[model samples]
Target: MKLTKIALLLSAATLLPNLASAGTLEQVVKKGALNCGVSTGIPGFSATDSKGAWEGLDVDFCRSVAAAVFADADAVKFIPLTAKERFTALQSGEIDVLARSSTWTSSRDTSLGLNFTGVNYYDGQGFLVNKKLGVSSAKELNGATFCIQAGTTTELNLTDYFKANGMEYKAVTYDTSGQTIDGFKKGRCDAVTSDASQLYGLKLKMDDPNSVMVLPEIISKEPLGPVVRQGDDDWFNIVRWTLYASLEAEELGVTQANVDMQLKSENPSIKRLLGTTGTAGKDLGLKADWAYNIIKKVGNYSESFDKHVGKDSPLGIDRGLNKLWTQGGLMYSMPIR
Candidate 1:
């Protein structure tokens, strides 16, 4: 059932009568499933499969977290959410963690009563228009109507970009990304604007995917990541390290196919990451092999990227800023030791 925004907000508020008392991990453990909020339908990030199973990069992140906690990747209940309702759902404890492809912004971080663990994808806002539009640059999109999802940074970014360029346009807002793309396809707007990565995913839904062209001009920075409520440090650490474990596993040459072989390695970093020589997992209030379960079940960052949005997938997005720090990218993990 589709709940109205007001109803959803009130429902979320009811879940948390006491904001000060937080125990997300305990609640999740008692329930035996991690409640993960994800996008309603973003093909490469979070969408349902032919069998009605949620599968995508963000979905994999949720699975990884579940694996870390319960040693079972499937122990997660995927709650599909719209952009407008994601934060409130997280705030009200409607979901244990939000693996939605939400950007990490200062206002959201400081004002939303939530904590972003780390960036899962580094992206930039861009426009998607029909190839017939013949518009090559975002600057040339003056006076063009745009289809944008409401309650997203994309709307504000679009407004700011146009204002800075002294251009004016009409915004056709939708509650979900799929609806925004549908609005664009149905000619409600001349263009659709979102993170460039999402534009690729959206194009997959087009009648003729090749008809859509993502303009070259990237308008704004969008560091997308997972989020959890702020009060519980333990849950925060678990979520944060779960992401870091994926990245670190990639850097340490740990893939799902080879994790078992890696367990016997002598490298201190690998040993610590696999819980063969450290207490990092226990320190985070998780089992000693928390990272091991994540790597074993969900693979590493590179694996998940390749399987969901990289060259192996339809999106074909390059690692760019999502690559490891050692590989000249921004994905640096904190020390597990």
Candidate 2:
């Protein structure tokens, strides 16, 4: 009897970590809202509007996750974080998931105890400068000073690019993207370097948007996406598949305006995606119409892109690498089944 009791206790102890790892989804359901980590303010990505409501590509991704879990797109608390504070917030459980425009690098993936679910935006580093500087290309700025955001891959890339070109430069660092751009506008640096998409967004904030232009050189690859804490595979899958569902919806020609109509789709792929003919929802511990809720409320990935940062939006960014795979771009979804 003593031996049996000891064995039982040992087995239960081994299962404790697993139970803790699986609690994120359950805690979210009980809390009635997901705490999402986002940037302080990067327009077209995760910034607030005139009405003080959060809306952007990253914000929309957070809403989609809320829709999948609670059937309510607005059931989320957006916590703005800086680059240095983002990882700490996620590690401390202050936020459930991070949807900020953060890059997926090997050090962050391995040493930080985090896992990047998937890439939502494929980006590269570039330079933005005032056209009056008489420099049309990055190679012309041999000894320029750059305003860059601190605690980001941007600083390292800037150093590497200049070193490789046998040139030299100085860096003026800021805590947020907003401040980085402000430093540029104030002439604190000769140029600003960041992700190309971000330079576009920052350009819009200028008093005369056309005064600045992104340079032709792209120095580094930045695959930005959502991130979840390590050891929580269940929550990871929910977030990962939430992004995939949006992509798959686009592939199947489904949109927020037509998700209901697509439910009647006879195609097996559409059927499984809409939760009408598969165990996808059951496997995720969500309702049968979970994905349907995501599409109907949040919309497909392409829809969010167009509305926030693409051609339909103010940024007017052309869909280069972000185009769907069928169109020769890199946006591809995994099998829903």
Candidate 3:
């Protein structure tokens, strides 16, 4: 289900506009829309609603940056991309930032001309299969046909996981998660391979979720996060810290519901994070209330996660490895100052 070559060519053409002489922050401001690259569809992380408007965890990342820069979360134009096209789109300057669920990897770091801002989702690859297949473990799927998204580590990881486990499986590669899931549901693949968090999102979207079982084998490390072109250190810092601010806000006990009250906190960390203690935002070329705009408008990471992908949502994914370092998870925010 890879996007046809023609589509990629068209994407390239669309992205061929002369790169602005200024940094990405200026381009975003001038264009009046923070062009964002997002997944084709992954419930709770990035998905289109019934009304065709995008909303999810990843979507909020883009919105938070928009809010910090433009003081409005809604000033974003999302470009939905297949995994195959996402890196190319970003590399070609088609989008100011990519809020897609992309796993950070060494090759991507050097070859893609992109910078992973930070790990928004600490994850590992996993398997999902029809319960009727009676597959208890990944080791048992020696002859399985794995449906995987192409141009992603998931594809190579699928091959590597099976090889490392001393098993053999064929792979049916797709550019989009929707195509992979649809193929899997139609019995075209024995298993669907992707990040575990994504497995949770896709499983909930399946027709017979109860019958679709995600295996317990946690395969490769997959730290899904945002990415941007490799240039303009200042612009990169703005994007990087915007993500950190959300995590820091959560760590410092700031939330959308309490941001207004937390502004006057005596705690130095809280004060700095909320723009009450210094001109940190100005140093980043953003308004003094840049972080405040994010927290007050977009909420903290925990708040967004709970609303979009937590216990109450249909995806219902446990925070697990994505929880803050204070909670014993890998999530750790950098100091704002």
Give the per-residue lDDT of model 2 (tens digit) for 1-337: 9999999999998666445556799889889999999999998999999999999999999999999999999999999999999999998789999999999999999887789999999999999999999999999999899999999999899888999999999999999999999999899999999999999999999999999899999999999999998878889999999999999999999999989888889999999999999999999988889899999999999999999999889998888999999999999999989
For residue 37, what is the lDDT in candidate 2?
Answer: 100
| Reference-based TM-score of each model | 0.94, 0.94, 0.92
What lDDT score goes with residue 63 in model 2? 99
Q: Tell me, by lDDT, which candidate is best.
A: 2
Task: Write down the TM-score for model 2.
Answer: 0.94
Full-model lDDT, candidate 1: 0.92
> Which one wins by TM-score: 2 or 3?
2
Could you give candidate 1's per-residue lDDT for residues 22-139 as a string of tens digits? 7778899999999999999998899998999998999999999999999999999999999999999988789999999999999999887889999999999998999899889888
Clashing pairs in 3: none
Judged by TM-score, which candidate is best?
2
Candidate 3, residues 51-130: lDDT per residue as tens digits? 99999999999999999999899999999998888988887788889988898889888775678989888889999988
lDDT of each: 0.92, 0.94, 0.87
Q: Clashing pairs in model 1? A: none
Q: What is the lDDT of residue 255 in candidate 1?
A: 91
